[model samples]
Target chain A: MEEKLSVNHLLGIKNINQNDIKLIFKTADNFKTVINRSIKRVPSLRDITVANIFFENSTRTRVSFELAEKRLSADIVNFSSTSSSVSKGETLIDTVNNILAMKVDMVVMRHPAPGAAVFLAKNTNTQVINAGDGTHEHPTQALLDAYSIKEKLGDVKGKKIAIIGDILHSRVAISNILCLKKLGAEVMVCGPATLIPKYIGSMGVKIEYNLQNALKWCDVANMLRIQLERQDIKYFPSLREYTMQYGINLQTLQNLEKEIVIMHPGPINRGVEITSDVADHNQSIILNQVENGVAIRMAVLYLLAMKKTENVKN
Target chain B: MKKRILLDSNHTKIMLRRIAMQISETHGNLDNCAIIGMQPRGIKLAKKLLELLTEITKNKKIEYGELDSTFYRDDFRKGDKFLIPNSLNIDFLIENKIIILVDDVLYTGRSVRSALNSLGDFGRPLKIELVTLVDRKFNRELPIQPDYVGEEVDSRAKDIVEVIWAEENSSPEVWIITDK
Candidate 1:
């Protein structure tokens, strides 16, 4: 049997295969041209309306998704968790249903609970795009990260990528691991023993605790932010100890034999996971990742809208 | 399957020269005129025509752009198969200028209509004209006709007319592939 990418709902990176990722990259390539033009707007989604429902705090992801929707000419309605009825004890289903009653064509949601997106997809009548779901997955972020690597290195296959920092609680790390491995990249996770998951070896990834060796062995290093709010119990003794063990500083980067590209899914704790000099270095493609995020998201929303239009026709 | 070769590489060259002369005779000197091609296939014809026009006018400057109509189509997303968009590379302004829209073949005029809608984002033009290599006269669903044509052919609903270029096809030939 042949597997096909179902565009009904973009729940997670696990739901899509490598070909689907390639297709998104191809579409995003076209959109990158659209954005560079003098009139950086298209009427492809003019007939459609989208609702951005963020049940968690975000600055970059929310803004990226909103700009993508606007560039597609889709009418957007922004709903924040602080101002929305979700704070008044309304269930997820009821809040979503009320929003749908106003006639929204799609939903881009960010919730703090894992599997929240899957639950919405199973219950909602509209198309669902997961912005982020707890510590489960941030598929678009992973996609943009992969895209940035492709743009810089010209390919993702046969490249070594080392993910550093809080591996256990970072949704970006899990999604990037799945995405990079699927694209045929050698992936390794390096962090403190407590921060790295116990059963991650079952998922077929090399776990490394020594940051220097990991940096030397990899072509690219993606630094993840340590989520202090998400961590319930103390995973490590102190921040200073963790920084000394795993932090990517200018001195360590200068000691490397080859020039390695650096990446960080931002809201960076500066000196904790990555130093200021390394983050602003010439090899760092962090800003490129942010720019590609809009294109990746535009590709997702456009393709899913096309699928939805096809369904309506039938 | 039955195939009929309408124009070979030599005939294609001659016809392209004739089309260029016809365009030159009408516009005199193409200073404010821009040649825009419908992407995926029209690009080849437009490029050839632009080169010929440049030669005929003794190296006069002319603008050439490619427009992708995938997103502008009215029937977009209505098909069961996935739609892949082509590259759009129009960098020049079209406002108050003569626009020559070029394509390989003019059939139902649906693609031209889509191109018109897509061109709205980049300023409005003073005038727009259609130029095609092959005009399938009886196949037009809309009341549209090309102003400048290289050849006229009669094709059935099941017959496919293909313009093969040296860059893509093994040989440069204009032929019709028919279902026998």
Candidate 2:
């Protein structure tokens, strides 16, 4: 028999154990094989229903989640704040309860508030999957990231993965650090001091200010997009100044004189954080991360649904 | 618990040879046929049977593969235990090719049903036949019967049928474990 996750709701990577990560990866391997088949679909979750509630706008996560749900044969109901009753003055719990009344078994939510998904899980009876909740966590993104790394490197232990770019306002970085640390991978956060969080040292990761030094010391560099929309004040002097100090061009990568996998969680600032050539280079796994997103999400949904069914039976 | 031996190593070999001879007699040309085994347990039987089929017929024209249908199982969320899946390793096209589905035991017939559904995703086969070493009569939940059976035995619901192939320091034999 398959082992299920310890926690029912995926609120954050901090709430999960190492066994849960192993279980998710193990299940994703089977799903990776499934998605490669000629008729790519599974009827594992046919009796269940899922609702994707998004308070923030997203293209990749939204499409990836919708595809994952469809391939699992689950009935999907989508909810966006722009077209919902929240505009008039409905509360978050009330909005979720109304959808639960319609019999949605699980909720994949992306909200602006930090603890919105946790709060929803406490108030509702259904399982909650935090797609992204502000700067707190994005569990699924971290999972697919780790899975992509494992797929490329054969293992996550003892491998160096440097998360570059904005660390101050990124939910992906927080989740990634927790996930990679549990999987035994050494992590480093590199960016301007203003963009890096102060308590990052407490998170058990090295902080690098020099892009070239970070590149020389790492095996895989995961460049995150600068959250320009989330920045209300100037984190650095100027975009050009930031690029000159921290941007990774082809020359910068070649200067290291060794092979290092390049990664970017997309909508990248082309010339600021990473050059176009490096992003499209053979070492880049940006597209593989996107492709593995569906399998990873399918694994998350399938495992969580298994727990929900057992709970009902009990 | 009580254990009963049904076939010894010598008898088991004779039974397998008889099954192989029957296949060679029924279908002389295995060029258009694919020998597939169900995952987890059936793989062992399929491998042994394919080796025997090749030796008896002296024909090297048959293709071999392994199939898994854990996703198409009917008792997904309804079962008490979580379902673990094995990797599917069919690297060939079954389009218009005859398929010989192999398994070690024929009880309940649900796994066979699921395997058939899984095979349709590969391609449309000309015909599909089932082969089993042990046919547990009066235990089928579905209307599935083996095209070639090594032996037919009657047993209670809870009795376990075990097939031991000659591998890893053990001789080949068949046993039934029943509780009184």
Candidate 3:
């Protein structure tokens, strides 16, 4: 009944220091144990309702959050953009208020517009978990990425991380860059000149366009999924040209540091952004990121719900 | 809070000796037997058992491992972060080996459920026997019973047992810290 953690409300990784990350990792480690059992369900969030509001289409992130809610024993009400009143021109706030009227305890929202989750949090009494908000942030994905890296590399501090692909359109890359930098890792963003933004370097990240240079200096090469939706805007000459230049393949990987861990935020575009061999390789933490996603989200939800309950009681 | 001495250091040492003797008599020898201590105080208790059992059986080959049920707890996501020590250094294979799962307290049988979950990550054991230093009754939510209990205490829901080891509290004692 004591106040726990609500890590999703964490707006920026810049505010979180090493000790905070350690606490999150420690808490996530405990939840990892809860997931391995035959009877994995816990009564922590019993009778609590969590709304899954997605203003976009998804498979793994959506299902992972739903499963996380169920595992915590919370009732789920899923709202998709296609089925909701958004199709009828209703605003995001109006739809959220409608769900709030039903007394949902928490809302996990993913929208195409940046700052949508933050906006919902300001308007609603319920806790807002940013599953993904346009190109702004996906905190849980970043947390799981950090967790996966910590599990493999023992510590992320001083580790050189090369985040390659469409840096401008990738929420995953943005989150990972912020998180990795906060945890004391030197982050590098490398991609085609059109795809990589120049201002991202202001976030204290080093920018590189040459994949060979980025791959050589990095301890972790994180290949972000190139949002195909952004391709039509002339970000590159062509998909084949982009893959030929920047896609992490067997040849690029061979030139990379052998101990370097490969990572990707899923729904990978095979032969477009990354090669199948590197994605499926032993060094890849892509699947581990998915597994850690559930645990991290569970930790985030439990913490937020418990904190709100404590605030009300107080 | 009532200061109760369920099993003092001496009594615990003697009970561990007797348990070792019984195990040897029934299970042939202590060669294939491993003593796994549950996290926090259970690990210390198991280490103590290993020391006592070694003295009684005169077999120095008894393996000791520690298991942290922090990850395996049912209420893990529900509760506040209570930092405990890391997991056991279990190197040997548990397959076909007799495993004695040790814990400091047994109340509501939930911790044991967590311990069993923690055990499943390791290789399967031929036999797993649950042992607890204290067994408080009428709180079990699961169908689990400890194989060996050092002491049985009748308690209400408000009454909680705090087992302090010298490693943590600078002294070893079992006390009933009551809400009333």
Give the number of the best model, judged by TM-score. 2
lDDT of each: 0.89, 0.90, 0.77
Residue-level lDDT tens digits of model 1 in A58-154: 9999999999999999999999889977778999999999999999999999999999999999988989999999999999999999999999999
| Candidate 1: residue B63 lDDT (0-100) | 88
* Quality class of the docking in candidate 2, CAPRI style: medium
TM-score chain B for all models. 0.93, 0.94, 0.84
Model 1 chain B scores worst on lDDT over the 10 consecutive residues at: B164-173
Candidate 2 clash figure, as a count = 0
Better of 1 and 2 by lDDT: 2
B170, model 2: CA deviation in Å?
Answer: 6.5
Residue pairs with backbone overlap in model 3:
A5-A303, A33-B71
DockQ for the candidate 1 complex? 0.50
- Looking at model 1, residue B103 earns an lDDT score of 94
Which scores better on DockQ, 1 or 2?
2
lDDT for model 3, on a 0 to 1 scale? Answer: 0.77
DockQ of 3: 0.15
Determine which window of 10 residues in candidate 3 chain A has minimal summed lDDT: A1-10
lDDT per residue (tens digit) for residues B53-122 in model 1? 9999975679889999777776756667566787888778899989999999898899898888778777
Q: Could you give candidate 3's per-residue lDDT for residues A1-314 as a string of tens digits?
A: 22234343654454445565666676677677667655566556776898899988888889989988898789999999998678899988889989989988888889888888878877767778888888888887888898888888998888999998888898888888888888888999999888887689899998898988988888888888889875557777788998898988877777654668899888999888788998888888899888888887777776666566455544
